[model samples]
Target: MEKDLAPKYLIHKDEKLYFAFAVIVSIIGYLFLIVSIVGFIVWLGFAILSMFLYGLMMAQIRVNGIRLSDKQFPEVFEKVRELCERMEIRVVPDIYVIESGGALNAFASRFFRKNMVVLYSDVFDLINSADDGELSFIIAHELAHIKRNHISKQLFILPAMWIPFLSEAYSRGCEYTCDRMAAYYTNNAEASMNGLTMLGIGKSLFKKVNRREYLLQSSQEKGFFPWLAEKISTHPPLPKRIDEIQMFVGDSSSSAFRRTSRAMWLVVGIVLVIFTFAGIGFLYSDEIEEAVNSIVLDANSITNDVSSDEDSTIMVQAVAEGDIAKVKEQLESGIDPDIQDADGWTPLMWAAQDNNVDLIQLFIEAGADLELQDYYEETALMKAASQDHVEAIALLIEAGADPNMASESYGWTPLMTAATSGNLEAARMLLEAGANPKSKDGDNFTAFLHAKKEGYKEIADLIKQYEDNVN
Candidate 1:
């Protein structure tokens, strides 16, 4: 009993109106900033610049088709053509991968002969390797976007691009429309569900990650707070989207697909209606409007100020944990292993502590300063020695870290620290590198005495052997 899921609504039927609105909204936004002549000019200048940039991007879509011709997977183009035929679409957009996209994403651009589809590498890798059913269904969904002219409809709502509040609504509507088109072409309700799930929920290594559980989790996310957040997003919540397809295709009979009762929608509608009027009233209220403006300004300022520290921290921790893949991500993002954290600890320091000799060698080759020290005046070698990481000690010594250089805080050479900790292997390596065995610390304790106190018999024996050789 699957019903027609095709988007019956022609999103772009009124392109002229949409174009008019884009222009009108741009002008209105500019005018709104006209409290001062300087503000008006600034606003107008920015609007013009944005329009020009977007125009340039649109112009590039023509060449995008040529660029798509060089794709690593030629089969994608064939799939696009087949889907376009099935959907009775007059044009199939040239598809290309934006290798720069580090996340999963796909977007369609308007063009003269054909629109353009820019698939991120992440998404292409997923779809290209999927089973035939999953892969074909996904292609159909993208085609449905073109067939229903969803991209044009979104362009028609261009005013929302200027109006932040309405812009969010416009974006979400586009997603809903595309989902309907996807379900229409896939025909199987489950296939459309699978496509949406893939987009929202990335593939997991654990095969037991249940789709039913995922749909349930998505459903629970539609409470008041979550729905409010969705209002500001360009896409519907995954559960709501899944429900939309299931409802359209008469698949709601599944317990997992059944939505909250009609009464719930009624209550939500009343609440929304009330809030709409309330919002209109508040916009006209000087005090409320001022408060809203202040909040917006503060939020924007905060967002702009939060630096990208997570990239470095994650890289550092991954290096410590000996994770090659995570290290690669940071490197790909142009992270510097030599870059010191707040405590002046670099990836080399973490590698030393973890006794990761290979990673130590890697960081050294990547231009890590072998002499860099932490707040504790511990060089990577010192850290390796204190933890008795013999292999790491060997790598650092080979990397030419100065064995004679004493820590500024502890005033102990690498040899003194290694001897005191009873790391005989580290002590032997440092001594061979011409370390001054007699180097003393703040406590005036020599490497020999420290080794005795730390109960390092083997290190003590090595130190005595060095002493005898000196005599």
Candidate 2:
């Protein structure tokens, strides 16, 4: 039998173009930096800051997160080693998982010669809930970033970061390249899509989300705001990301083609406009400098006279305090119920975290978004479960909350939380409301496993019974 050739999903055209654009812009930035000794000093400061920050993060991950090794997280360690061999990565990067609270994200970084990958605990848990292939796609994605030496490349282009849209475009291109590499390494397009979908919605709900309809939603996001948002974003939107993966697999008939094509033209148009402005600025340097100085002065004058609104802060505080009257007043005054505080926590989240069932009801009645995640990607139900707030959990479910909804960061449904905390009543309530007992967390531990591990015999027995009944 003849040997089969591996499928080749090469570097995307946009990736190449954007990278070239970034290099050119970086060269120009370097030229500008060399024009003045102060500019060179500023560039040096930025480089030092970058190195220091990465080093600090590396230290934090080592100290606080679990390091993958032969004994600890052995399965993931094996995957990492296998991926490195397949990708031909010489120096296997150190991988660590830190407590992310509820944030579901991962990143690969380098401090001088030391390359490391930091996986958020919740994001790492995807390995258990989804197929290991999905986790492999994610790992390969990060490894692809390291293998491509993207961090070092960006370090050289540090000066280009000052360029408004150009740097963002280049960063987005790098992301697409890494995504392609991840998909190629895993050789599973659907797994890759599911991984990205998990990042967007979380683990439990991702399966229920229609991938085709989700991609179509991107087409409806037209006009300047959406276009400008994409142009200045560090990563392409999730739908576009899925499209890029599809393109790699030679599936070009979908609407992703149209959206991606539009995005490419938008990038080209923006780049042209940026270069034209740069040309004008160079041709009329003195006039541009004068206008910039005037604008800065005006901005300072306006800043000094503006007073900040404290109403949102007060509203959030009232919700946290469970002051029904104050909450009612705020709602009556037409304050947005969905407004997030500084930490991306809405008033409803505050109420849920506080386990105030009545306050939750009030917020719901006032049109609060039940599914809103805080900075940690924790829904209200997750928070309630974490605290064993039975009444709150019952109320949330009665109000149409999905019992199977999992946090994107932790991959734990309410049932898992109840099991971990040994809250038997809460676990029973969740089971009765249709929560999946077999649902796993980021670590792949199901509610049953959590119950067993925690010595909650009753809960474990209940879960076993539930599984048996389902079977």
Candidate 3:
């Protein structure tokens, strides 16, 4: 909401311009969404699939990487905490060091609200070197990117990335910004330069290279292609990066970065990407057409319907229709009282959901498992409470059903479910049956809090009374 504490010199010169264009591109996307719903749907589906694959990749890294903590890499862990305090970042992200075979690099990643930082094993070795500040510089650079929320911003600016050199241009500017913060926080221009050098060359000789001589040779190179190559790269060239840090800390006299018009290349790149996708679409025209037609014919169509097995199906139908005799017949015929459907729904769940107390008792007498959860981990007790089925709720509770059972998805206990519907009877029964009034759901809302939200003061007061006594 307010301006940040960081000084202006820490920001790249052209970062705001590129970010404004990113905002405009997002606006254009919204316009397209309004005029083209089908296109938006396709884009959304592709985005979801891509995110799922990305999550799996991150999970694999987490499983294989060694996490830095108090007991593991304690020095690095302490340094990171100190840096976070300097940056005013309250929550420190999970940091992991992975074996990258021989790669010397680090990166920031995220999924949902959780942030992660990964430092390669080779880069992690720099802590033991004379240029140990190089490791801190790299760590600070990655932390700066996380503080700026760059990965989430990438998703917001995704539409603009298709414009050929635009992605690289923005990325290079981001590198400049992050580099500035890293230098400012680490306060070691030489270590930062050496760190950038290690990225380009290898670990063995980066410490041996002369910084003055390398920058002089890089400065002497004069050609349009060299400038163009720098422009087209997602990261500024290593020498250019090193020079920028020198200028930042008042150790250099020249600007190491410049930007020129990329309009022609932008047009060319957009045309190429469109044609590439168009060609692939042509080759798979039939299959793609069928998929589109099916979606267009039924916009509500999402998941395929899964049918239940025969015994479960009959029991569920009998419960739905209040056919207790048929349910009894099935129970007497040696059917498993707890038989579940393809979706993991059981007969007791169906009976409780419909407030069919007779069938609930019949199933319980026939050895039904009251705690069996459905595909979403919803128990019969939760189902009964959600629908305000008082008789069914009492019957299940008397049969030793857990009054505090919560659903898998929302973490809502049976009392919270009952409070949401303003069912005082169900709430009273649940509370009297020993349901905890202090338990919170996924949104951090307790039954009392939920009752207060829906203007159910009676339920709220009742829950508050129990909450006070319990506390």
Candidate 4:
């Protein structure tokens, strides 16, 4: 940990803080697990199996991909060897240059003890053509990840790996550390910045981009969605990484990392997914088969589970759970389609939540009341229209559902609900189905006004068109 391969001045200041926090939480979690020996043994077994399967998958990937060797792609191979020598790494990772469907990216991977580097063909082309050591910076960046043992340490801190912002912050800090070392290795700061900029914009556009204005614009962009997206991401965003590279080159000790771009955990993810489904299928074979069979909407399976007593409970429950077969069976056994629960919500109302067209048709054919209101005084059409369920709205309207039916709370009619929610298709369906666009909600806002207030310009425009045609 004390050995410095890169200059001490370039390393990120907060990398140690975030790593230490995760380590502390991991230690606390492990100490509590010490009390439950059986549970610990089960977890240990599962971890071992996952590692074994994922290691095999990585080995297969290395064999299948085009490997860079002494005879082919020798320049890239030499860079790997050179970086390992400079970083004091004991092993030189095998580098593979593979075509990634025009993806301009690269990744560092390790399985068991063998490390591998994957370079997309386009990134290799871009880096190979550059003269200012951008290729060296990219190779050195991945090498720094190996030198720091970022991948291996995740096992010990497994408990804290999925804890919301904590692990993601640790990962972003690791990325900053990598960027600093890479910038230090290249020596030419602007070239290293260009290498990162190439990742954000494509290969053809990096030279023309004004870095200062780009950074300023990205910094000024603010909202809850952007903040939440970065908080949940594993790597710092490309612009943030570029800013950190600038700080590193200037020997500034401050941190400027935030947000994320592409993900890097893709190497082992495919193997884990394959083994997860395989393990689950093997463990629950019978239950899985039964569940699959129960959902077959054939006439034979749908009419099988008839009850002797005429009870509405099973039919209502089946409709709520989306078990179409069970619902049909209950209906065939003489249960009422308009059966209400304690809250006066019918089977049709429960089915409306998912906007199931088949279920709605069955209730309509059974002579269920289309205008029936729940405890909240909302019709099935009101529920469907607000969600922009166009197919459901069309079917309900064709079956004579009241398009103008209003719910109790805001007295929001189906058309007003669709407009307020910015559901353009649902609003159009309601309008075409003869819903009155001029009708007002409890707040005295018409559907047109509702669309305008909610910033739905297209919906407001459509409402205006309908009003103009009427005039």
TM-score of each: 0.45, 0.54, 0.58, 0.51
- Which pairs clash (backbone N, Cα, C closer than 3 Å) in model 3? none
RMSD of each: 18.6, 25.8, 18.9, 23.7
| Superior by lDDT: candidate 1 or candidate 3 | 3
Candidates by lDDT, descending order: 3, 2, 4, 1
TM-score of predicted model 1? 0.45
Position 268, candidate 2: lDDT: 45
Q: What stretches of model 1 exceed 4 Å from their correct place?
A: 4-44, 55-72, 100-102, 111-114, 127-130, 204-208, 222-224, 254-471
Highest TM-score against the true fold, candidate = 3
Q: Which candidate tops lDDT?
A: 3
lDDT of 4: 0.72
> What is model 3's C-alpha RMSD?
18.9
- Candidate 2 minimal-lDDT segment of 10 residues: 1-10
Each prediction's number of clashing residue pairs: 0, 3, 0, 1
Ranking by TM-score: 3, 2, 4, 1
What lDDT does candidate 4 reach at residue 399?
90
lDDT of candidate 2 over 1-471, digit per residue (tens): 121334223455555555555555666778887898998997788878977886886777778788899999998999899999988885577798889888878899864345688888888887676467778888899999887667766765576666677678778877888888888776778888888998899867877898888887886788888988988799989988997787667665655435345235444444664454444444554353344345543653344222112445778879877789999998897777877665777787778778888899998888777787777777788778877788888888889888898888788687887888888888888899998877878898888998899999999999889987774
lDDT of each: 0.64, 0.76, 0.78, 0.72
Candidate 3 global CA lDDT score: 0.78
